[model samples]
Target chain A: MRHHNIRKHLSAYAHQECSKDEHNIIENHIKTCIKCALTVNEYQQVANFSKQIPERSIPSEFIDQLKRDTLKNIEISKQKHYPPFRRLAFAGIFLLLIGTVTLHIVNPKTPVEYISSSDTLKLDEMEHLASILCNKENLIAIIDQPIPIHSLIVTLKQMKKLNQRHGQVNNMFERIMHQINGNVLQEFPTPLSSCKIGGKFDESGLTQMITCLRSYQRYNDTITFRYIASYYQKIRS
Target chain B: MELHQVIQKYQRPMVAIACRMLGNLEEAKDAVQEAFIRFWKSDTQIKGDPFSLLCRILINHCIDKLRKQTFRRFFSITEIKDLDIMKSNENPHKSLENKQLVDHVEKLTTRLKPVQKAVFILRDMQGYSIQEISDLTGFPENNIRVNLHLARKNMRKWLQPILKED
Candidate 1:
C-alpha cells in the first residue's frame, strides 16, 4: 500500500515532473527501494527508445501540391474581390496625373541652345555628311570632319524610320545609337579637346563601341536607338 | 504541388505504425490515405507537433475502422488465421525472442481499455507528454494520468515476473 505513493512518484521522477520536496522523497525512497529504482530505470529506457523511433520523411511533393493549391485558392479569392476594371481605373488615373505634371516641366517645344550658335556651316555640313554616311559600310564607324550636323540628324531620322518600318535594327545601327548616346558624342564643341584627338573623328573609338555592344545583344533584341533627345542638340518638336 | 509528394514523406512511418496496429497492409493503406484526405480538407486546427497530430489521426482512424461490423469480423478471422499459421510453422526458434517481447506487450495491452491502450502507446511507445496525450485524445489531463497509471500497473505486474525470472 505504501508502494502506491512511491510508484505514483516514479513516473513523475522519470519525466522530471516532481516538486522539489516530492523529488527528494522519491530520491530517498528509490535509494532504499530496489523495486521503485527498477521501475524508474525501465520507464527511462522506454522513453529513450521511443525517442529513437525514426522520424518519417514527409513527401516533398505533397507539400508542394498543398502550396500550389493554397496559392490558387488565394488567387481565386483575390479575383472575386478585386476585379480588373477597378485595378485598371486606379492605374489609369495615376498615369494621367503623372503625365500632366511631367509635361509641365519638360515642355517639348523649347529649342536647344546649340541651334542658335554661330557655326551654321559646320552644323549644315554635319547634317549632310550624316545622310551620305547612312549607306556606308560599318555604319558605326566615325566620320572624318567636314560632315554636316543636318546630315547626321537626317541619317539618325532615316535609321529611326528603317527601324520603325522593319520593327528591328541590326547590330550596326545599335552601335551607332550607343555612340550617340555615349558621353563622347554628348560632349559640346567648345571643350572639343575631350571629343577630339589628332583633330579628326576617332575611328578606333567607334570600333570599340561596336565591340562593346556585342555583349549587349543577348539581353536586348530590340536594338533601341531611342535616347533622351531633349538633353542633346535639338530636333524640331 | 502534388498530393503524391506529401504521401511519400509520411508513408514510411505511417505505414509502419498502421501495419503494426491494424496488422494488415490493405487496412493500413486505407487508414493512411484517409488521414491524408482529412489533413487536406481542414482549414485550420490540428494543432501541435505535426508528428503527434499525424499519429493521433492515424490511430483514431484505425480504431474507427476496427469498430465497423465488417472489419471487426474480418479482423477476428484474420487473428485466428494468423495464430493457426504461426502454429503450423516448423521453425519456432526463429520467432522465440520476438514472441517473448510481443507476448509480454500483448499480455499487458489486453488488460487495458481501448483508451488506456492508446494513451499507453502514445506515452510509452511514442513518448508523448500528458498534455500531448490529452490534446491528441481530447481527454482531460487527469483522465490521461489515470489511464496511463492503469496501463503501467498492468505492464508492471508482468515485468515483475520477468525480472524475477531473469
Candidate 2:
C-alpha cells in the first residue's frame, strides 16, 4: 500500500476496525517507515487518553428520585385526561344554582298591601305608593290586587279638567294621561265638565264609565292609576 | 424488558457516554433522566434493541443541550468545568494527573463539531464499534467512519504539543 493510503488507515488500524489483511500490511509497512511508526504511536496515545477519562457510577439517590418523579408525572397526565363533560356538567350546575340564588336575593316574594281608593289617603303614603309603582317587585305583587277602576277614571278626569284651568299642572296631567291610555279619555264623556254645569250622569252613563274603566285593569293601568291618584290627592291637600 | 429493568441495566453506560459528551456529571444525569422520560412518553413501539434506542435518545438530548450551552455562552462568560472522575484519596499524584488529562480531553472534544464529538467519544472513549455507533446514531457505517477519522485527526493535532510536553 502507498504511504498516504497506509496513513489514512492508521486510525482504524489502531482501533482494530480495519480488515486483517489491511492491518498486517500496515503493520509490516510501519516496521521500516519511522514516520508511519511515530504516527501510529500518536494514534495509540490518543486512544489511551480517551479511554482513561473514566466512567462514573450512577448515584442511587438519583435513580430513586427519577422513579419518584416519573410516577408523579404519569399521575398528573392521567388527571389531565379526565372526562371533559363531567367538568362542563359541574360548571353548568354551579352557574344554574348561582342564578337561582341571585334571583331570590334581588326580587324577594313579599306580601303586597291592597290600597283601595276609598282608603284614607295620607300625604305620607304618597311616597310609599310612588315607590310601589316604581319597584318591579311591588308592581308584580300588585298585579293580582283589585284595581279601583271607576274611582281612578273619575280622578283622572277631574285632574284633566283642572289641568286646563292651571297651565302648570298641564305637563303632569299630560304625562299621567299618556300613562293611563289617552284614548280612554276620548271614549268617556267629560264627567267633570258636566259636573261644572251642575249636570249629573244618568245611570246608563255611569254603567258605561264602569265598563270602560274595567278594561283598564291590566298591571300597567293599575300602576298609572295608583301614581295619578296619589299625586291628585297630594294636589287637593 | 420493563422500563425499570432497562434503567437498572443501561443507566450506568448511558451516564458514562453522556458525561464524556457533556463533560459534566450533573448534566449527564439530567440528560439521562430526560431520555428515560422521553422514552416513557413516546408512543412508538420499540422495534429494535432497547439499549440502542435509549442511547440514541440520550445522545440527541445531549447534542441539543450542547447547542443550548453554546447559545448561552454567546451571551455569557461562564465556563463548564470538567467533572473529576477520580477520587483524590486513592492516589493524590495519579488522581491529579488523570484529572488534568481528562480536562484536556474534554476541552479538546468540546472544540469538535457535535457529530464528530459523538462519533469520537463513542468509538474511542466508550469502546463502541463503528457499526454500533452507526446503529445508535442512525448514520451509515461510512458516514460514521468519516466522522470518526476527522475527529481523531483533530484530536491528534490538538494533543501533539500537550503529549510532547508530557
DockQ of each: 0.06, 0.39
Give model 2's TM-score versus the native structure: 0.53
**What lDDT does candidate 2 reach at residue B96?**
55
> How far does residue A40 in candidate 1 sit from its true spot (Å)?
4.1
Top candidate on DockQ is 2
The DockQ for candidate 2, computed on C-alphas, is 0.39
Model 1, A125-195: lDDT tens digits are 43443443343332324322222333334344444444455544334444433445453344523222222
Best by TM-score: 2
| A-chain TM-score of every model | 0.29, 0.33
**Most accurate candidate by lDDT:** 2
Measured by TM-score, how close is model 1 to the native structure?
Answer: 0.40
| Runs off by more than 4 Å, candidate 1 | A1-3, A14-20, A34-237, B1-5, B41-55, B66-111
**Fnat per model, in the order shown:** 0.07, 0.56
Checking candidate 2 for backbone clashes, the offending pairs are none
Q: What clash count goes with each model?
A: 22, 0
